[model samples]
Target: MVIISTENYEKIVEFCSKFKGLTIHCERQLHKKFSDIDSQVLSAILSKEWQKHIKQRHHIILKSSRIYLQEYKAQARLKGDPFILLQIAIRENFSPVSLCRILLSVEFEGKPKSVTNEMIRNPHQIPDPLLAANVLNCLLNDKSDGPITDLKRQTIGEDYEIRLKKLASDAGLNFHDEVYLRRKGYDKTPDLKLAVPCMFRGKIINWIESKASFGDMASHQQYIKDQLLSYGNRFGSGIIIYWFGYLDQIGRCPENKDCIIVTDDFPKKDELVLINNPFGPLLSSNISNITNLL
Candidate 1:
């Protein structure tokens, strides 16, 4: 979830600039390369003669009495198919799936939680909290011949701890700060320390740890309150976020309940902060022109 550094950004730009014709690296493999992606995606990224290519293709199709590419694209969309569009973006090199996943992970507004490797092995069945955590962990801990990856342990148990620490640091949010894990006479200290500006003038605001679901809050309020009390605040806040990926549905922490649920949509109750999505509205508008933007 770390923000892309200028150095990394430059590297990516340089990589894109040098891309060969009609070729791309597949997302599932760092080393595998393929040439059969959407011509549009490839054209968008690597071809300087995209318009000429399109025009010549159109001319050939017209001479042969075949469907025009632009017309075909419109037809496919009208037929309720996103596969073509997705393929084009993926193939033509608009952006790699890895980069998109990285961007989403970077912008995520919730705390990183630990999930089992079994859950990661079968993400389709797990909860969002666990799934997201595992996905972020894998991305952050990906094995490349890089300085950070070289230092990480190979075993899942050791790697989990290492990855979690890295994930917290990447998120710019403390995950284990002031928290401790005690097992058989060994106590492991937290990696992250929650630091938010003091609220109510002088009182330092402590945060509560709880699940990211709206349903979990009503059931788990006492446990969260207890965590808050372990620190020093009767008025501590819990940062709540919805586990569902929907951009329109908002979640909330109860009013005056020493908590704050952060979501993209406004909460029905008080004591929540609504984070804005830069692409949500645009996507909605594109999907349906009737959606009111005003």
Candidate 2:
């Protein structure tokens, strides 16, 4: 989880206090506009106008909010209600100025109107320190399914791969790191590739993608669409490890037969010694259900 400083919280509160009213765009409406207009044309027009708008507003944009918006759009499409996802920020006490700035930056067609005064007669307020803390927590931690930095993500991913390699070695299994698929003279690589021909009913598990953060439904879906599906197409099956156990209670992947394993579910070194048998009862008991589909 990400932590927000007291100074930053105060700044957010001060920023939000300035906006008397907020104008919001609907997700369904925005999708319609996206369908009608060419994405490149829309992006150019919005970028040109938004730069001017921000300059006139005399407000410095938050880089984190800007990055958040990029992922938020994809989440909106999945939820089928952009407003619902926006509400997460709103309820978290996101700066009205920042929210408005981000939305205006990506001005969609149709000129969607803000909610009427009847719905929100007054601007949102952060009344007390406790409330402010809650707001700050939500802003930084909620829906932080995307990485803050590519370098940091790469580091975490490498660490996970190393750990998996150790686990494979302990189990007397072969671990191939950064293995690539060669098709028609082209190369496509996955993070970690393991082939345990003698383990788990002789399954040939090809790829293992490690995610450092909580694999929420939105982020998981994006992973499936962007990376996992392509791997599945090239290689028959693979495993995805959510280190935080975010998807443990979320149940099986309804969309695919591939395995979704949470690292947290496995017993630690102090609890029980992992054996050389790859399909030992201890390990099999936890993953057999998911790997069965593989």
* Best model per lDDT: 2
TM-score of each: 0.22, 0.39
User: Tens digit of lDDT per residue, candidate 2, span 149-248?
Assistant: 2345578667777787676566555545664434334355556555432223233455667765545454667777777777777755656666543333
Off by over 4 Å in 1: 1-167, 178-192, 195-217, 220-235, 241-259, 262-294
lDDT of 1 by residue, 1-294 (tens): 112233533343355444432223322221222243323222222222222233344433334222223532364557644233234323343322222232233333252423232333333434444334434443343332112333332343244445444543443333334344333232322222344322211222233232222222333344335443333233234343222211121233343243443332112222211112243433333332212211
- For every candidate, C-alpha RMSD to the true structure in Å: 22.1, 18.4
Cα shift from native, residue 159, model 1 (Å): 11
TM-score leader: 2
Superposition TM-score, candidate 2 onto the true structure: 0.39
* Residue 287, candidate 1: alpha-carbon lDDT: 30
**lDDT of all the models against the reference?**
0.32, 0.43
